[model samples]
Target: MSAVNDTSFNSAVFLLTGIPGKEDVHLWISIPFFLIYVISIVGNSVIILIIKTDPSLHVPMYIFLSMLAVTDIGLSMSTMPSTLGIFLFNYKEISLDACFAQLFFVHLFSFSESSVLLLMSFDRFIAICNPLRYASILTLPRIAKMGLVCALRSVALVFPLPFLLKRFPYCHTNVLSHSYCLYQEVMKQACSDITVNSIYGFAVKLLAVGLDSLLIFLSYVMILTTVLSVTSSTESIKALNTCVSHVCAILFYYLPDIGLSVIHRFGNSSSNLPQVVMGYIYLLIPPLMNPVVYSMKNKHLRSRLFKAFCK
Candidate 1:
């Protein structure tokens, strides 16, 4: 096997694959994926429009929601096209530059979503724990700043990944595990020692997604403790109710994520279906479900959504 470690590697391309052993079902598979892409795009778009158009939703909670919707849209768009192309049209050839671009945006939105969730957790924490200070604490400017920080942080961390991958010699098979590119998946195809790439990847994931998840969990624990201490049972339920949608959103995002991580790290490569299915779930479910959960849980938003559609 000849090692391609020169400048020519800058133009090297990779063939993205559908589920490894399930090519025959690619056409049928495309249907559900297309539907999911449509739903995720439409659902998040509606959430953004509703929030922007409604004066009643000009609060911190809704502002945080809008940020989440935007991130969801970004996430859906980053990977959906290539994913569908691979499954439906068998367009498997992806240029190295294009693959890197996809990797950056996919990871950018992923970490952005994690950051937004952390922000949402803080929003809930303030609303539940210190209602009197909620308005004063999370003003529109502050929320905007938080969103900017999340975006910048995600970009800064994920930006280094493609460059790092570019430096490695790709003498092995250039076929990726999924229809989309990922840091570890791409790294695994390298021929040389990837000690630096491995460590950096671990540190990035730990610092970004892992730390954010830990903080969100702690925020919820504090929120729960505070809610349970409330004197009235009705009040406790009401407080907890405010967090239910966020809790569901968190679970929807992280559970599939953890499952995919486990499968990638520990599962057998011979069985590709589980990993592919879970990858689709991880990528598609949150964006599709977030607006639905939020609309159903928040009466004000739901009523406004209904009135807007009825018009």
Candidate 2:
């Protein structure tokens, strides 16, 4: 029973490709994906450049912006390169090991990006509501430490995924739907009973998506309370405006994350097609949207980026 299951699980027959009919659409789909990739890179790179050059924007908010940009770029780069390559070529095959490796890093950075957004929200809260103590609370050393902590936290949480998957006997299918290797997607292809994999994946989500969202929600609650208490309308508006980009970023960052977690936990494996599409949308959309959100909402970032590029 187990051997037959393993063979079936490891076989390429399990791989889902473009629906048997709409093969032609693959070429066209890449157009928008390629465009978004370009925008994400260029926009994030611009944010980094502007931050480095414009000392006036060197406060904690921009520092968090820089961190968020870095994480966004890192997350997009992990999945985009391989995905884009597939659009241009015929042999879109990946080894099991390579697939899991990409999955681990992509997930690790995705979680880290979430943590960074949470940190950024907190930074805005301090800057807007607790203006007097913003500098004291969000000093350079503290930002650096936060970055290190989140990076370490994400890596530690996700690194075990690859090792755990390697233990599952390769039953059959190696072809991953969409671009990168995903846990639930690949677990269905496992030779062994996937109960263990499912359990561990749930645990990963608890640490990654579960707690991350809680912290983010709490941070915003504090921010909203602080913003509302202001006596001066101008001060209140300014404080609220300061959080605009952060709120947009958080929405972009969390909506898909929460959506994916629910799909993995509740949606049937047969319905993975929707989840796969949703995964790419979430993965690709946020990075591209971050710059749009920040550029449109943040006058300071806009002005600094303009001045830096102009010079």
Candidate 3:
């Protein structure tokens, strides 16, 4: 352990960690990560393009899907640089400012994604429960306003994090546990009292991700109730089926996220390997899987994709 008073805030450099005990195979490991990045970028881009170019798909649901695709791209890009740098080029050292910037964007996209998912659930709820007024209630201008509010909320919540973390003096080992800079991971390295940081981080997670998750759950509960009230079982099945893609999106996004949180809170240093692996899964899988899920489940998207590629 270094002396607490020895390190200055401006001079701090954090070493981003790749997979533990896999140093000899980093080049090999980079192969799959590179593939994941390529697929994620290409897949999400295709989804966004399909939604944007098709006037028929400009409804609130597809528009929210586009927002999700954009956010997934942002999330993937945030970690890709440092991750590939470390594995392919042995570039592990990240300056404090660079790390903070990366952390901010990562969280921004993450929270934004959460907000988009919540909005998507609302879209579904309205479409299923009140199909008559869905159009009037979810006008294009109103959807745009909802998106702007979500973005602004995410920015306002995450904007203070870098500055807050910057105020703390770090004398502990500056090696980050994952290939990217995360708020909790960075705060752990600070030698000073991180009470405020901890509180703020917890609050942000609670208010942003936590609240989003809770509302999403409630939305689905109401959806299910409404779904069950349908006198025709076939209609009920059809209505629920429409949500299949979104449900998969939610599972992919939140399951690993919850697993990572559990591991971080309960696991010790021995859990580093799982932590890193889960971190990669949490970040990479959703972007890569979302397009495939949506295209396969959504008839409109699937048809559009087939027409574009088959032609």
Between candidates 1 and 2, the TM-score winner: 1
Error of 2 at 69 (Å): 1.0
lDDT of each: 0.89, 0.78, 0.93
Query: Which tens-of-lDDT digit does each residue in 205-272 have in candidate 1?
Result: 89898999999999999998998888899999988999999999999999998898889889998777
Worst 10 residues of 3 by lDDT: 1-10
What is candidate 3's lDDT per residue for 43-142, written digit by digit as tens?
9999998898989999999999999999999999999999999999889999999999999999999899899999999999999999999999999999
Looking at model 1, which ten-residue stretch has the lowest summed lDDT? Answer: 1-10
What is candidate 3's local distance difference test score?
Answer: 0.93
Model 1 accuracy (lDDT, Cα): 0.89
User: Which ranking of candidates, highest lDDT first?
Assistant: 3, 1, 2
Candidate 2 per-residue C-alpha lDDT over 1-311 given as tens digits, one digit per residue, 9 for 90 to 100: 87786664444332334323345677787788889989998999999888887778788888888888888888888887677766655347766677788888788878888888888877776776677997898889988999999999988888888888877766464555566667767786666788877888888888877887888788888877876787788887877777777788888878887887678668876655767777877798889999989888887788876776797
Clashing pairs in 2: 6-171, 9-172, 9-173, 10-171, 10-172, 10-173, 11-172, 11-173
C-alpha TM-score for every candidate: 0.96, 0.90, 0.97
In angstroms, the error of model 1 at 9 is 3.8
Candidate 1 TM-score versus the reference? 0.96
The number of the candidate with the highest TM-score is 3
